[model samples]
Target: MIALNSIVSTFNPDDQQKFITYLQSKNKRRDTKNIQLFKFLIKEELSSKDICKQLYNVVQCNAYHALRKRLFQSIIDFIANNNLEDENSIDMQIIKYILASRTFLLQKNYDVAYKILDKAEKLADENSLFPILNEIYHTKIQYAPYYPKIELKDLINKQQENQKKHQLEDQLNIVYAKLTSLLNAISYKGEIIDFESELQIILNAHNIELQDSLSFKSLYQILAIANISALITTKYYQIENFVLKSYSILKQKKETEKQLFYQIQIVYLIANTLFRNKRFEKSLNYIQEMQELMLLKKGIYLKDFILKKTLLEALNLNYNNQQQKAIDLIEIAISNKHRDIEALLDLHLSLLMFYFQKEDFTVAKSVLSKFYHTDQWYIEKAGIDWVIKKNVAEILLYIEIREEDLLYSRLKSFRRRYKKYLTEIKQTRIFTFLNFAEQYYKNPEGFSTDITRNKIENAFTWTTVHKEDIFVMSSYAWLKSKIDKSKLYSTTLELIKKA
Candidate 1:
């Protein structure tokens, strides 16, 4: 779908309104088809053929295609200009500085040009933007013959050093791309591959070493790889040390405006890892840091990360015996349109689970309604795993609401869609969970039986306390709550207390 209507679909109602205003400013004529076409696309839920017919009411096919291309190009320009205006957006600022310097350098304004280049070089170096730094150096060296004040030999040596650093970063990028490909293969092709061994192979091929002077940009990719490994193994704690070290290094670098984006991401990763490993307080602490960073540069990255921060905060609060507060946090956040659609889906499902735990089935179903799109839509927006989770939640919700027919029908579809995927990932416990849920649906009283408990335990095994995933424990706690005839919230809290 490429997100339904390219980047336009990414905008929520608020963004749509903002884009209208932007388009108004960009429009040279009052009777323009661009706005009309945009309004039509957003207003109607029609297929391409129908849309084409409607669009061609007064225009020929060639004009329609030309108008479509112009509208698409306008959207691209709007997004580009909006990002360029971002506070402390270093790359754009550096480019602007370079352009300004080049303008003066053309007129033999050596003094002014050198000052601008100096500023650009400092900004690029701080952000470890080697390619941009090379550009700055190239301009300086290019004009060296014209300006005698600058040292040509010094500039050449500096560029040579930067080229080496850039090459190293390129190697890290190779490893990063390889890791992404490996993960995609595992999911799309259902290939069984060892995470560590595959990661090692890529690192070896790239001649990367942990002991090297890895820059912040390199560490970001490495942390991403660590996150991927943690996800595959369910051993988030294993990467804790490396992530913390990277964050510490970033902190020691003393906050560059250009590195703010990476800083926000690294802090979020730290907070997420802690939350996954059952360190709620510490996780919340880092989340506080992340939120603070987001507020910087006039909250330029806020839209990018608000949902993620809220999801983490809500999770930590919920675990700390503040379920209502957590629920309230997410409720307020979910009302707005954010760019992090993946995180939006997470919050939607998390809120649904919270309502289900509270026995607020009415509210739970309402939250479920917000996920009004198809599973294919969700799989593209989130992932296949998230889609599977949603399906399971739907089936369970149907069972809770006493919709027997819907529950059975959803079960049949869920199995048909995900049975092979579950087997590929060796996560067929989902089937076991559905089986027990079905039995419970048949006879609620049977949940208290020793045989039912035995069946549940046989299907769901645990290696140790405080190691299993929070969501896994959540589903188990729901079943346990039914078995013990206790409150779902309390059962969940007591169960995860060990983790």
Candidate 2:
């Protein structure tokens, strides 16, 4: 029992051989108990080769059935000792050891089996053992003769390495596919699935050593892309630093295509961040840089498609600042046939604003009428489109003869019926409407007191409650002053002073 414990603890090949020799010298005919003990020792410690040799000798001496029965009992004893009845609970390392033993049991060479099992054990230790074990069990049942020991070992190692490389590549590909799907989903009113956990799983799989290889450089590029998307989705403001680090790594390897892709994404993200922060000119400059890169690439790349949309956004931002360059860019985009319905809609909205600024109500009304009649008008309101649709509502109110009462009632009804939707309305558009309503009431013509009061009050209640919204803060404060001149005036004055 002490010897058996040593064998189990050490698991050394030399210890196994000593047990095999001891078993062979024991009595085979005189004492059945001794013979059984010998067989048990053989099963417990020796390689399958030594066990099989003893079985053959017993059969030659006319004790074949007894030896076979003893061999079966030994197998049962080994399993019992190891407590391995439920193979599912066995650690991958132990399972690989068992597989190695079985390979020798089947009269195959030991070296090939040991190498394969070693690799499997390593993978199992990394908590990535499931796939490898599944493959082994699947192939073990269809056991064939082992003839290619050295070659098979080399091939298995190569394949395992290749599979690891492919997994990283596949993750990068998935990130791009998911980002494109998300953007397109927003365009088409489709739902986006939560991809954060899955992305983290992939990132965790990446090994720094693997990234140093030429074969994995392409995959590293993919990793960079995935990281960018994760940053964008999670609003990780430190994305520029993360991207710059990844870019530096890629640049060190001179991976130009990947570098270009990462650069485009970085530029896009920076432009988007600037736009959100209301840095219109900086956003336009970033978009122009993206456009220049796309032109340099002859418009054949994925970045080109992305830059086209961003260019429209930049133009819209410029138009918001009442710049003529915005109109020039829109005309160029429309004439070049690069403008989709989104860009055209943006252009129409810009033109309406431009006309409004110039007090050309006739052209503004005409342009807005055409915009309201377009297919995009309905498509933009499908609740999935990311662009604000309230702008259309705002324009429609401008041209309609009975707009004041009807528009106010419709907006109020929408707020009450779709309280959740109210949260989704763009803050910029909400503030625009609020400011417009307030200005209309303050007109020298003397607006209706009760109607204007209710409109201002409703806007105030909604906007002030969401006071973190920068666009609506001023309008909210102004409405408060109108509603309660004394208390609100002092509070609003303090708030504005702080701003």
Candidate 3:
């Protein structure tokens, strides 16, 4: 049941209907039970034994298991064929052309063979389909001796040039893989990476040009890496210039229909980067551009980006003094039927932060409670950083409400889980900040606000205001507002304004 249901869950409702049609057309026997199993899987959550009993009117585990295996293979074949015929299958189409040309050439059909090669080469070149272009050139040169009107010297030169282009592609692929490793290190292993310096070294080692080597997909990956690095370091302002420049270069390229997905994500990254830098107006402008782009092609990728768009827009709106609008935006996006669990966790956490800032403790606690799953579950679904934030929020919310027992439990849990990691990463300031909160919660009358503020100012190594992360500042602001005897919401905004 789990095996078949996993594949079936990959299809959207429309695709499920299409799959039904697909099964009906491909059915070999008039009495096949594969379709019945598929429908049952989609519409119910019954166990394998229950499903088997329902389908067979008895416990026929052996027959049900065989049907499941067959259906799984059918889904795999369907997905493969569907992907090949998709509108975004330009590269696959070029490969198909190359294969057809080679077959025709073997049969001594020169007219059709050369014509197909020419067409494939043209499309491959236009799209910067370097890997496919490599195959195309190899085929052309392989048969250069057999075909007439073919300049062997010219074909060799073209192949060499193609090789050089794809060699650069190979280098970029290495850089991408290394960047992914570096990103995972920062995200989960609690390693402090100097991403900008590391990226510079990577580029130098690979001989990749800053401006020329990056194609659309490579640029998006680079931006994503930089964004994650910024997020982990709490220094978003450092990446603002680089992200903007990358997007400006991306804007000049003639974006193909297939590359639209990357373009929308690039735009979102730019908006998010700018928002982190407190450029709310510019961020909103880019978010508006992203919206216009999402409306293209009948909103095919809209659901894929709904949470991202809403999160960025809501953030911008929150900072722009439209707090209710921000809340409304997120609430609508949360109610969306999108099943991206990681993205949903992000939205829930951000909403929790918003309510906490508003000083609505009850609502904030409610929002925090929405993270009803275990810490281990969230760590798997999101990441260590998200789980850390969730734990901190829980502890702080309990502190606010003076729930001593819950606060102690959360404090113990957080220490056991993350203290060693944060300390190892040279992020002890987080511990210092949370400690102050706990101290204040335990003995507000005995807590020395002035001494705590002074200690925070001196003990914590602070970066320049412009380079500090907003969320980091927000966390600090809770202590600041308490020390200065001010409002948490305004203090958070003021810290961002200064930054």
Candidate 4:
């Protein structure tokens, strides 16, 4: 029994001679029966198919390569004789296991593959001969994927069924398409049809129940849906709710490769939503959480997440009254040049606002000069033109206030450029107020007419939708204070409370 166990244990034929010598010296394999058993064991390990034909040539009862080959063929024939289904047959299962395990190996998913192979070995033992079973088991121990305990067949089947029933892929495509259409509509650059019906379709596909027993794929789908919903509604509350729910589910699940992907997505969504809602401090917390998670999974590709986290950190610091630190971080991000252009542009815009608030024209001019030098400056032609006109006008107007030499000619030129882009600007209250503010500053005496006041009030109503930005609220309050001090004071207080 010990010899038999040793024979089964030799995984490679290179070690067969050592075992054969040990067995022969023990005098247990001098006879034909014992010699044949040894040969069979060697053949099973080597997977040789011509060993039996050469058995007659060997006089001594020792390890023979020919006998080893013959025994290997016999095992193969046995497996062939037994009908195994293509999908569920033990042979097919083993093949699929091998393929899947190889894929996981490439992905560095060793634990998952090892778990899978372990289960496969148990299943194989119930249906295969000892020689074949031993070979399969030893093969698994040698080469396994990460997380082998996760049975691929079961996971694939479950995910496939869920995907079909939920139409998750279809729903995601629809949502992406709807968002594209909505953005096009806002820009008047594409289809003008309403996307409400399509939005409904996407919302209907969200299965909150799946969150209770969330798989990695399900978590991914949920995150995608939540992000799309947030974009559609422009509401951070919905995003917060879904992200928190997804985070809870990920916490419950094992940290598999798929789960890691979901984790990254969830953290990104949370951070972005918090930033959009102007919950800067809360956003920073989520960014820190994401950074920790990424550190734990050291080799993961997280360039996008890192950039976004950096942006959030800078924005949060600025909001919390740490302007210098915020500016420093923004400069770091810019110097790295590793972030997306859009994010960089946003950072610069925020920095511009900060400088404007501080009345630091020298630094603001330097920052704006660098910004206009970039390729993105040309890309944001409309916004850049508006900012130049607006800022230049304010600077010239300030100089006039200080009783400096008034550059009326330059002011007129700036006003002309501002008016040139006025019609192209979106009808949002913020832009309208910006336009009115420019005009009011240009000629305060004539611009305080009732008609102008009514238009500013209407713009104020629209601006309230984005109450998260204190600058916008303060501007609105200033306009209202001009009309009615008591109403402006109360409204300003209310906005502060909401902030």
Candidate 5:
């Protein structure tokens, strides 16, 4: 095990000085070797060998190990003696009391144990720590024989109630965890085939009901599950209704920091639903609403929330033919160092699409270089389905730069590698493109034909035909631009206007 002081030192630098001071004051040793050792562990980047030579002046391995164990115990004692009093610390405070009761009861201190247990019971009840409440009830029952004043009837009834509540809480947590796992799985694939039967099985097994007694945590899980279901089946309107109902539940209660965050999250969900449904204007309204809510709160995680909103806004702008504005927003979003690799990948891909559509081949090439540079390793790390979009982006780039040789090579390689992942309809589009590209590049005289025009029109329709496959970039517009011999932005603008 690591020395507790060493683990604590790795925390935020802002807390390091105060923690060090606490350790120094609690050292309580005349030799001061323990204090020196604690200071050495915290500040200096010294190895065990360095410590043996510099601090202890000993080469024996056992000496360093013994010193580390002692330091660990000292830090544990200091942590046990010190307590922080605050709202955030209330749970720990209750836990501390319960632990104290357990220790006192083990030593046969009945009166003291009962006093501590009573205090712990009140704290746990007030905080709705049902699990801890169950523990307290168990401790109460175990000590009931020693306390003559203990009412067996009342204690048993309360214990039964707490146990029931604890069971319900556990069930809800299990369902929530399962829903979260489901979300993660669907995020990569972007679809789940015929989940109706499976959904019924899960629902029946969990006995899930989102009603008045449901806690905010459980309600959030329900909303998440609903969102995932909608995304998998492309049922955006259903999710919108579910979110509205859940938002009503939230508004009926007192506002808190947690509620505020969830409120923003709900609005984001609504915005995304509208965006996916191609109601860009309405989506922008909700995006603005989310921004307004974000302005009222301050937190560390809020940046990620803001970035999400920005990305959605950029998507809205891009699809609405406002490429420059979308590009600007995407640049701003990617400027931040995001911890979410998927979000970063989305931003990079969006930027590539915008620059490519803008016909700024120079900037597009730069973005493509960065995409190619990181995407290979990043996709593996992030576990997202980026290959389809990545290959599509490469084809678009090669087509633009008139790199017929590279385009043919990449097309052949992509077909061989990712054939299984592509749907039949998607594979048909790829084959059509490859055949057209081969003719267009190898024989310029045969580039434009009645057959080519028909293929381009069909490809354009397939964008909506396979809209459910969001992982596919639907490269129909680029093909259309090539067929019509028009600017890519012009074609996109016309299409947006027609929509």
Candidate 6:
């Protein structure tokens, strides 16, 4: 798994440039070595010796180590000063003051220490930084003997209050983490067997009452658990209630930058759930809301939100029987620079689906070509388990474009690669569909029958049973469209309507 902190850093070029600029501004001599070294470290894996030889032209190990330390320190300094205007900076500054106070206390400067603690306490209280306020209270109690002017009763009361807030935050955070872990576990599986009992256990254990969610963080965490549970259990309508609750709570307050990001996530979760439920118009409305928020905030995670919004819009259009419009939107999405390689791969796949559904075999083939070329890199970049889905799409593409030889080879390859796992996951329809598709490819004229076509349509329907979560299986409709001699999109829409 990718380290959590490094995940966002993977595609952040703007932050790197800002760090370089910050370093330049900080240095009196404008030394370029540190900036160059930082850039090299980010882009490549190199030893200290390699870095020393390349940048400093020295063989001394100690000298290289010393320079490495300085370079590391410079990066830290750059990050510290980069966004002091951000709201979280209040917490950061409070911590800094607390540390300063500690240093003063150690040096026997009681006056300076108490003054620093007072400043930190005021900032913590003003910002509702209860966690930091707890720290402030502890520090004040530690120095109480040195300063008898401190009111012990008042300090004790505030400390108790901060402690309660900290406990609440901690409980919410732990519950959120557990829910997030469960969500990740079920995401790829795309099915639920008996998660309701587990979810109830979590709620009971965590004492997670939505009514008790008094803070933004607590409310967001509560909604997140509900949203993820709804997803896992396929209870999509449940997501709407949580979404509304989150929106109502968030709108009533002044959101910090962090809260806004969480709000955006709530919007995404609801829109996605609506889309899954085939509420296309409502989904599009949420998508618009998300887009407006993106335009208003332009958060650092802009690329991800844009990718999601664009994909949701495309899916809404495609499922609503607007293949060409969906294709157009996907084209625009793929043309843009994307920080998320996984989303990019997904967009390419969606584009291929649109083209294939439209029976534009030539364009579909081209999209598949692009998909194949970039696929390996995307797998490496995103660490996604795409082997089954990727191979399945390729096989379907081959079938659509009438590449009989390629279709035969791809069918064999896909079965070999995913047969065991597909069976394990009870996704036998995928294997069945591939078998039917292979038969259809070799004998298109003889492939049609009420029995056989229904079976094939059932396979397609099974593939799309979790359409909101898993990749779409367009083979059934594609085959049905071919057998029925109808438009693929219209037939797929009918199948969806029936489903």
User: Superposing all C-alpha atoms, what RMSD in Å does each candidate have to the true structure?
Assistant: 5.3, 25.7, 3.6, 20.5, 7.5, 6.5
Q: How would you order the candidates by TM-score, starting with the best?
A: 3, 1, 6, 5, 4, 2
For model 6, name the residue pairs that clash: none
Q: TM-score for every candidate vs. truth?
A: 0.75, 0.44, 0.85, 0.52, 0.64, 0.70
Please give, for residues 324-368, the per-residue lDDT of candidate 3 as tens digits. Answer: 788888888888556688888888898898888888999988888
Model 5 C-alpha lDDT versus the unseen true structure: 0.68
lDDT of 5 at 195: 54
Q: Worst 10-residue stretch by lDDT in candidate 5? A: 465-474
Best by lDDT: 1
Off by over 4 Å in 5: 1-172, 179-197, 209-213, 233-238, 258-264, 288-298, 303-307, 320-322, 336-338, 372-376, 424-453, 456-474, 493-499
Among all candidates shown, the one with the greatest TM-score: 3
lDDT of 1: 0.82
Per-residue C-alpha lDDT of model 1 across residues 256-371, encoded as one tens digit per residue: 65567877888888999999888899999999999899988656577778888999999899888899999999999988756577888899898998888889999999999888
Q: List the residue pairs that clash in candidate 3.
A: none
Note the residue pairs that clash in candidate 1. Answer: 466-499
Model 6 agreement with the true structure over 169-198: per-residue lDDT tens digits: 788898788777666554444333345677
Cα displacement (Å) at residue 48, model 2: 77
Model 1 lowest lDDT segment of ten: 1-10
True lDDT of residue 73, candidate 4: 48
- Per-residue lDDT of candidate 5, residues 326-404 (tens digit): 9999897788555566777778877887888888988888887776554346445544345566677777688778987
- The CA lDDT of each predicted structure is 0.82, 0.47, 0.81, 0.54, 0.68, 0.70
